[model samples]
Target: MTPAPRDRILDATLTCVARVGLGKTTLDDVAREAGLARATLYRYFPGKQPLISALVAREAARLGADLLEATAACRTLEDAVVELVTTAVASLEAHAALQYVLLVEPEVLLPYLAFRRADDFLREASALVAPALEAFLPSDRVARAAEWLVRVVQSYACSPTAEVDLNDPVSVRVLVTEFVLPGLVPSNMLGVTS
Candidate 1:
């Protein structure tokens, strides 16, 4: 299927961001890349910030869906959390535009990393994980656990520590099971809950 105009614009924006970095990419660049006039681009995205925001939201949704699919077979809460974190980190690391923005133009992302946008990411991530968590935790606890998982995943993405091997699935799974699961799941239930 042909992509919508908005999607084309976002794709162009990401391409431009990857090439020039978000700090330098402009509406003109995105419009040219999308094969649209500046006015047409404006119709889809009024300004650069809104366009970037849309791109971020779209990418995050895609990643969240991928996480859900990747963990669909998980039989336990720990397994799900480990899969979620590992998948999220891997996805973020593989996103070229996102990596460019984070590594070379972090300031472009700083404003969106604040309370409102951060909460948006957290809410989406929480929603994605909530269903898996429902079998083992209360609704409120599930939400909190999801939020914690999102925070930890984001932390690793933004500033990975040398101690952990993010590339190794077994290493990530062990780390989450040992350090993260205990905090999110009550000790008594952790051993048996799925």
Candidate 2:
């Protein structure tokens, strides 16, 4: 299905930002990319900040959906964590706009990720993982697990101190199984009764 005009404008904005970095991208550049007049762009976004905010919101929703879909079939907490981390790392690595912001204009995204709206991002991310975790965790624990998963994935994606390759599915699964799963899953679930 074809995306709506506003979505098209947001896509154009991302393209513009990716091409010229956020500080250098202008409304005129977005309008040209969207194939709309500058006046029409203003009619839709009103200003640059709103446009950038909308773009970030859209990307966040897309990432949430991607995470849920990637882990939909997970039957165990271990499987879910593996799916979540691998999918998140791969998705963040593949996102052109995100990579552009991180590489060329870290300041443009640092506020959203680390400061101003960081809590909002964490809440949204936790909610996204809640459904997948529900099968293996109680309601109270689900939020904590999801939050931890998001933090770990973000840390690994942003900065890796280890030699493990996040993009490698086998390596990610092994790392999660060996290190993360033992803490997240109950002993009973792993067939070890106390």
Candidate 3:
């Protein structure tokens, strides 16, 4: 089955962005990569910014789907969280366009990741993650816990530390056990009855 024109355009945009940083990518470039005319591209997306915004939204949805799939088979919340963090780290690291942008055009992302705009990113990410956590967290507590998890995962993912390696399962499990789980699940729940 063929991808829809919009998806094809976004995929082509990612390829073009990966080849050349976002700053250098042009609509002509995307059109060429997509094998579509510049006019057709324009018909779908009015302008460059709109195209980029659509691409970002598509990627976020993809990430959300991937996270849900990764956590689906986990029998415990701890396992789910470990899978979530690990999958997020791997996904971000493996995204060619995103890695290229981060390496060469970080300023493009700064507006969304920093300052007041960051709250929007946090809110969106929290919403994406909150549903997955619903099984483990009370309905009232899920949003805050998801936001905190996003903040922690984002911090470690964006500016990694020597003390904790997000790629290492054991290290991630330890971080979850020591920090994440304790915050999400109360001591009363985590404590052994015996």
Predicted model with the maximum lDDT: 3
Residue pair clashes in candidate 2:
none
Q: Can you rank all candidates by lDDT, best first?
A: 3, 1, 2
Off by over 4 Å in 1: 111-136
Best by TM-score: 3
Ranking by TM-score: 3, 2, 1
Candidate 3 lDDT by residue in tens digits, 1-194: 98999999999999999999899999999999999999999999999999999999889889988988888887777888898889888998999999999999999888878879999989998888887777666678788889999999989877889989999989999999998888986788763311
Candidate 2 residue-wise lDDT, 121-178, digit = tens = 7888778767766766766777887887777777777788666677877888887778
Off by over 4 Å in 3: 191-194
> In candidate 2, which residue ranges exceed 4 Å CA deviation?
112-121, 189-194
For every model shown, what is its TM-score relative to the native structure? 0.85, 0.86, 0.94
Task: Flag the better candidate by TM-score, 1 or 3.
Answer: 3
lDDT, residue 12, model 1: 90
- Residue-wise lDDT of candidate 1 within 1-194, one digit each (tens)? 97999999999988998898988898999999999999999988899889988997798678767877877888888777777777777887888898898889887677556687877767876786666566657666888898887777767666788877776778888888889888886788776765
How close to the true structure is residue 143 of candidate 2, measured as C-alpha lDDT? 84
| Cα deviation of 67, candidate 1, in Å | 1.5
Backbone collision count in every prediction?
A: 0, 0, 0
